[model samples]
Target: MSEASSSLAYRLRSLRRLETFACLAAVIVLLLLPFVLPDFYVYFAALVLVTGLFATSLNLVLGYGGMYQFHHAVFYGAGAYAFALMLTKAHAPLWLACLCAPLVSAVLGFLIGAICVRLSKLYFGMLQLSLGSLVWAIVYRWYSFTGGDNGINEIPLPNAISSTTGAYYLTAVVVVVCLFLMYRIVNSPFGKIFQAIRDNPQRSEAIGVNIRLHQLKGEVIAAFFAGIAGVLYVVVEGTVVPDMLFWTVSLEVMVMCLLGGWYTFLGPLLGAAVIVGLRTFTGAYTEHWSLILGIILMALILWLPEGVLGLIVKPANSKMELSAETGRK
Candidate 1:
């Protein structure tokens, strides 16, 4: 190989090592955070991680699978309600509710995907948003069962994990496990098929790929994870509300991924951390936190279209691309 090629390979290897080190350092800090920080910030830390997982779930479809989903929070809402209902009405064990919450959302995803998977672009987004909004409205008004607009309050958690610190640890465990599974999924052959369909639908279909089935499956996977995020939220917060089911919830999760650089696997997680951190700190001081966040996001989007993390990774990627182009020439 040429000297330039050798240097490029060394640089890429060094970058990957740095990336891995950073990830490990983050995990360690999070593991030790509850012990170090005050009680309030511990809860705030849990919220950031939960929201990060939620954003990662949405990115699985929108960024990786090329789906246009507008009301992804419907499944998230379903998960929260399922967990809340199981606790309050069914008197189910915590483990059982945890297992079932995501399943309920997966079922919801299947039903919605069956209708929306065949459509594309604007129509798919519109149909999903409409159907999801309808469900949200029903939940909001179903006072007989759902507690209506006021929402279910002071919901109980399994006694062993009731404390905020304990709940944060539990959230950490679930989020880490789910993130590992997602990492495997996105890099697997099945995930590659999603990419195939997204990149060349006609060719993929010609080669016997069932586009709709893959798309629907993607929906189920994303929904299941999003549901897990909802479960974490309710478990940590000890409340379930109608607002959790709203379209705005979906927008928040989606925006995090977009802001963090949707193309990269870890971007949504970073994006979630940044957004939630800002909200927590900013809201502590001023009521106009949303405006501040909006302005900051606007600037990030204009300057670093890929994401904040994208800025860090861009140099390595650009150098690789340049090397490849030089070889081609």
Candidate 2:
């Protein structure tokens, strides 16, 4: 192999090592944080995890699949409503509620994806947005089933666990598992095809790939994960409301994906943490937290267009090396 190829391989190996160490260190720190931090902080961390998962799920489509889906909140809200209704109305177990949340969201995704897969780019996104808004309106106006504007309150925690600490641990475990699964999916052949579809659906289709089928699969996967996040969110908040299903929430998830650098696997997670951290810290001192967040987001967009992970994982400077090696040969 050429010197440039060798150097690139070496750099990739080093990056993989660094990532492994970072993951290990993060796990260690998270495990110890609950012991030293206050209960409120633990709860805050749980919220971050839940929100991060939700954002990352959206990234699965927006980042990898190159589909700007504006209806992600529909699945998230559906999961939240499913969990609440199951727990309160059906008196279901927490585990069962969690399982059903993603299933319902997957069903919704399948139906939506089936219809939207035929369209490309903006049209698909607009259609999903319209469908999502329709669902949100139904939930908001259906007073008999959804509890309407007041929402469903006093949602009981899982009977198997009583303490907030237990709840935090449960959420942390679930979030970690979900993230790991996402990581695997993104690194798999299926994920590669999704990226291919994102980069050029027409070219991929020309190469005998079933573009619509692949995109639909990705949509369903993303929705399933978002559903899981929704369940965790309601569990953490101990309540469910129509606002959680709004268009703004979908925008927020998209913002997190963009802020984190859509190309990087861990970008959405870091972005979510940053957003949640900023909100928690700023909200404590100022009522104008929204203004502050807007300014920060603007700065990030202008200065760090690639997101935080992009800053860390610099593109390999191999072009020059390749030219040098070719000259030597």
Candidate 3:
């Protein structure tokens, strides 16, 4: 190999070592968090994990696939509602409810993606927002079914996972598995095509790749994981509200992505923690927490364009690295 290639390889290896160490440390800390912290903070950490997963799922399409998923949180809401309804209305078993919930989100994703992939850029995003708004409206008004604006509360959770610690552990496991799978997908050959299409759709098409099919696949995968996060939300919060599907929720997730670093694989996760932390801690002090959040986001956009994590882990500029680096891969 050339000297430059050798240097790059060495840098990658060192980065991988650092990432592995950090991950191990993080896992250890999370595992012990419940025992050390109060119940409320434990629940809060669980929220961070699920929210991080949601944002990461969005990053798969928005950051890597270069798709505009303006109303992505609809899939999240869909998953929550599906899980809740299955358990409450259908009287389904826990396993069945969990299994079917993400599928519902996936199907919704496929349907919306089928149409949205036909367009690009702002039009695609707007169409998704419109469709999402329609779903939100339905859920918001369906008092008989979805409990309308009041939402479905008193959700029955299994005894094993009903407690804060148990729920936190469950959320931790699910989130970790999902993150691993997503990380694998992002590094796979399929993810390479996603980046190629993102960086240059015309050239990718000219190279005999089916662009629309791949984009649709990306949508379904992202939605499926977002759905998983939603299920976790129901577990953590025990309520399925219309706000879950609202456009503003989607925007909040997008902000998490930008704040964490869309160009890095784990950036959204970090962003989610920061956002959730700010909301939980700052909101406790004053009602004007949004002003602080807005200022932080503005600062991130102007100064830390690559995101907070981006400072430590520089984004892979090459399309071959899937347009983003996990710093682990």
Candidate 4:
């Protein structure tokens, strides 16, 4: 290899090592956060972790699979409500309730995806929004069953994770595991095929890729993980509300993916942290937190189109792309 080629290879290796090191450091810090942070901040940190997982799950379909999951929070709310209802109404065992929650979300994903995947782009998104709004409406008005708009409160949790610190640890572990699984899914052959379909559905269909089936599977997978996030939120907050299924929640998650750089794997997680931070701090100071957030997001969208994490990784990615082009020549 030429000296230049060797240098490019070295830089690529360095970037990989740096990424691995940064991930490890982040894990260490997350594990230590509960112990080090004040009580309130610890609780706040837990919210970040849960929201991160939720946003990341949305990113799996929205960013990687190239699907617009406009009503993603429907699955989230479904999971939360399922778990809460199983515990409170059905009197189910803790283990069973926890196990069934995500499954419920996955089933909803399948039913909804089977229909939504029939359309492309804008139509698909619109159909999903319509269906998701239906679910939210039911939950909002079903006073006898779902407690109506008032929502279910004081949800029963296990003794082990009832404490804030314990709950934080549980959230941390679950989020890490779910993220690892999602990362593997995106890098797997199935993920590559989905991306191919995303880039060129006609070409993928000509190649016998079964685009709709793959899209459906992607929806189910994303919904399942999103359900897991809902379960975590319920565990942490001990309540389930109709707002969890609202259109605004879905929009917020979409924004998280955009702010974090949905195309990049960790972008949504970072976006979640940035969003939570902004909401918390801005709300503390001003009554118009949403206005402040809108301005900040607009600025970021204009200036850093690739997202905050995308900006950080852009140089490395550009170098890698250059190396590939040179080798092709």
Candidate 5:
């Protein structure tokens, strides 16, 4: 190996060690957070996890698969409605309601992606936007079922995890497990195929890759996770609203992914946390919060164009490392 390659390898090893240590420390803190934090803060953190998971689901498609859809949050809303309806109307068990949420979104994804997959880029996004709007209109108009503008309310949690503290811990554990599974999926062979298709669809197809089928599965996978996020969101908020299914909500998630650097596995999560925290806190202090948020994002774009985690993981930036060494010396 060349000297540069050796140095790169060493940098990667050191980065991995740092990441592992940080992760362990974070896990320890999270485990003890409920005991130390106020009840409201714990509940708020649970919602933040849900939001982060939702953004990560968007990243699975827009970042890794190189697909853009303006209506990705349709699955999230569908999952939210599914969970809410299953609990309130069907009277299903908590576990069963959770299982059905993702399944419902997967079905929607499969059906919608069947047509959208044949189209390229902007057309795919527009079609999804149209379909998502159609669903939203239906949900809004169907007052008998969806509660229309008022939305479904007063959702009761299961006996096991009904408390505020119980729900927050459950959100943490579920999101962690789901994210780990997603990390494994993204690094696996199937993920490689998705990346290959994203990088070069024509070449991937020429090499005997089933482009449409792979894309379909990717959409379904993304939708399934979005569904999980939505269901958790409903449980956290105790209600399901039509606004949650809007295309604008999906745009917010997309922005979060971009803010955090979609190329990094944990970028979406970090971006979600930052955005959610900022919106929650800033809204309380100022009426010009949206303007302030725009300024902050602009700064992030200029300084950390690759997203927040990109600051740590850019192993090939030898000049920056050298500059840091010179400063230290």
Candidate 6:
């Protein structure tokens, strides 16, 4: 390789190492935050972590897999409902409930992904949306089981982590672990294949790749994470409701991903922080919190189309075009 290319490669490797260290340092700082911050802030931070996890799962499909599954809330809500039912109806322990919740959502994801994999991109998204709506409708109508619009209340937290501050620390640990797992997955060979499929499914298939299987695998993995986020949400909020399964919930996850800059691993976490911070601050001052949020989202979409992180990274100049032209000459 040329000296310039070698230097560029070295710089990229150095940057990746720096990023990994920075992420670890950030997680350590966050774990220590509960000691200094107020109770409310700790709770807020926990909520942000949960929201970030949910958005990151969405990114697994939309960002990496290039499949827009609009019904991601199905898995999230399914997880929450699973936890609630297990705890309330079956009288299961907190650990067991949490474990079973993600398993249930993973199964649901596998089933949905299996069926949806046969359809084209747009149709698959639409079908997922329809299925999500169906789940929401059932949750809403079934008052006897789900408590209808009122939601299930007083969900127990893990015994070892009883206080909100303790819960915040626990959640931070989980979020860090999840983010690390996601980072590993994205840097793995499987991730390369997923990105290849995203760039050109036909080309990947021609190369002997099973596009459907890869897509389905990605979807199931995404759902598993989303399910874990849902369990965390129930723990933090101490409730689970039908509205958690609604289309709006799914849209919020998408918005978080877009706002964070879908291309970067940390983008969803930053996006979730922004959203949660805005909501908490804005809702305190005015009754029109939704209007303010809508305006903010519109401004971000219009002005920062690539999201906040994209603005920081900046686009690389296209030397490939010049190289191709020179070769032709």
- How accurate locally, in lDDT, is each candidate? 0.88, 0.86, 0.93, 0.91, 0.87, 0.86
Collision pairs in model 4: none
TM-score of each: 0.90, 0.91, 0.93, 0.94, 0.89, 0.92
lDDT of 6 at 244: 88
Candidate 3 local lDDT, 136-192, one digit each (tens): 999999999999999999888987787899899999999989998999999999999
Residue 243 Cα positional deviation in candidate 2, in Å, after optimal superposition: 0.6
Count of clashing residue pairs in every prediction: 0, 0, 0, 0, 0, 0
Give candidate 5 regions above 4 Å deviation: 1-21, 294-305, 315-329
Which ten contiguous residues of candidate 5 have the minimum total lDDT? 320-329
lDDT of 2 by residue, 149-180 (tens): 88899898855343567767777888888998
Candidate 6 lDDT tens digits, 215-275:
9999999999999999888877788888888998788878888898987777888898998
Runs of candidate 2 with Cα error greater than 4 angstroms are 2-14, 159-162, 316-329
Which pairs clash in the backbone of model 3?
Answer: none
Per-residue error for 100 in candidate 1, Å, reads: 0.3
Instruction: Indicate the TM-score of model 1.
Output: 0.90
Candidate 4 lDDT over residue span 1-329, tens digit each: 47667777788799889978997998999998877789889888889999999999999899888898899999999999999999999999989998999999999999999999999898999999999999999999999999999989978887788788988999999999999899999989999998898888899999999989999999999999999999999988889899999999998888888899988999999899999889998787889977887887789788978888887888868877987778656
Ordered list by lDDT, greatest first: 3, 4, 1, 5, 2, 6
Shift in Å, residue 244, candidate 6 = 1.0
Of 2 and 3, which scores higher on lDDT?
Answer: 3
RMSD of 6: 2.9
Candidate 2 colliding pairs: none
Q: What is the lDDT of residue 273 in candidate 1?
A: 90
Comparing 4 with 6 on lDDT, the higher-scoring candidate is 4
State the lDDT of candidate 5 residue by residue for 1-329, as single tens digits. 36556666677789889978987887888788999999989988998899999998888888899988679989999999999999999999888999999999999999999989999799999998999999999999999999998899988886557677887878888898889889888989999999998999999999999988988999999999999999889877888999998877887887788788887788899889988888888888888976887787788777777776766666655565774455455
20, model 5: CA deviation in Å?
Answer: 4.1
Which residue runs of candidate 6 sit more than 4 Å off their true CA positions?
Answer: 2-6, 316-329
